[model samples]
Target chain A: AQTIHQWPVAEIKAVGSPLSLGCTIKGKSSPNLYWYWQATGGTLQQLFYSITVGQVESVVQLNLSASRPKDDQFILSTEKLLLSHSGFYLCAWSPTGVEQYFGPGTRLTVL
Target chain B: QQQVRQSPQSLTVWEGETAILNCSYEDSTFNYFPWYQQFPGEGPALLISIRSVSDKKEDGRFTIFFNKREKKLSLHITDSQPGDSATYFCAASAGGTNTGKLTFGDGTVLTVKP
Candidate 1:
């Protein structure tokens, strides 16, 4: 069985502060990883996706970035947070097609 | 392009009743359609999926009906229960030769009463 893990379940930061959300996938290798953001009571939006190590694609320009430092590790970060950045951030991993496994997610609140 | 769209932004139904949720897509390339259920404070989970080649797929009380020609699909939940209350998102992906990148709909919040 494969499992995905995310950290800090919840975080509250002030505007202009930096943000970092981590994700780790167990039991899968070279899986496609994705970052999604959902505003309060809104639909999920694709932020970034990575197919392999050292390569990440930005689907939306929300002042956020992602990196696949390792095959099973994905990180979402921002140098300075904006008030609009507050939302639920989800990390997902897909082996190939259709089905995907998602982590618990990090709830960020930029005050 | 907001490839996928779901109807009834929110719905309320009584227990033991049936709840019908609708979805439509604009991308003709989409061959795989999946419905995801998300509970409060939790990540969305794959509920059921149907391939474009198939007209219907069923799992327990949940059923998915696909119409490739009309570019429409729907999820029907029979005997709705309070536990079945969650937001449902419809997603589509071009299955073959594609990376399984899903384009999701806005979602419909279903609330079931007792």
Candidate 2:
């Protein structure tokens, strides 16, 4: 069985602060990784996706970037945070294009 | 523009009643559709999915009805239970793209009364 883990279950930061979130997948090698953001009462938006290590594609620009430094690791970070950056961030992995399994997710609050 | 849309921002039903949730997409290239269920503070979980090749897909009490011509799909939950209450999101993806990025709807909150 495959399991996904996300770090820093929750975070509260002030505007202009830097932020970083991490995700890891166990029991699956070379799985596709994705980052998603959802605002309160809003739709889930795809932010970035990675097919292989050291390469990531931006689906939407929100001043955030992602990198897959390892086969089982994905990191999402920002140099500067804005009030609008607060939301629920999700990490998902899929072996194929058919279905995706999401991690526990991280709740972010920007003040 | 939103590529995917879901109707009835919220729904309420009594236990054992049938609950219907409607979803539509604008991209004809979208061949795979999946419905996700999310509780108050958890990540969305895949509930059921249907491919354009089929008109309907069922898993136990959950069923997905797909209308390719109308570009519409719906999720039907039978014998609803209070534990079924949650926010349901409809998502679509163009398969074989490698990216597998999904476009999601605003979601419909379902409240099943016991």
lDDT of 2 by residue, A1-111 (tens): 999999989999999999999999999999999999999878899999999999999999999999999999999999999999999999999998569989999999999
Among these predictions, the greatest lDDT belongs to 2
Tell me, what's the RMSD of every candidate? 1.2, 0.6
lDDT of 2 by residue, B2-113 (tens): 8999999999999999999999999999999999999988999999999999999999999999999999999999999999999999999999788998999999999999
Tens digits of per-residue lDDT, candidate 1, A20-99, equal 89999999888989999988788888888888899898989999989999999999999999999999999988888456
Candidate lDDT values, in order: 0.91, 0.95
What DockQ does model 2 achieve?
0.85
Residue by residue across B1-105, what tens digits does model 1's lDDT show? 779999999999999999999999998989989899999899888899999999999999999999999999999999999999999999888887425578899
lDDT of 1 at A42: 85
Q: What is the lDDT of residue B41 in candidate 2?
A: 87
TM-score of each model, in listed order: 0.96, 0.99
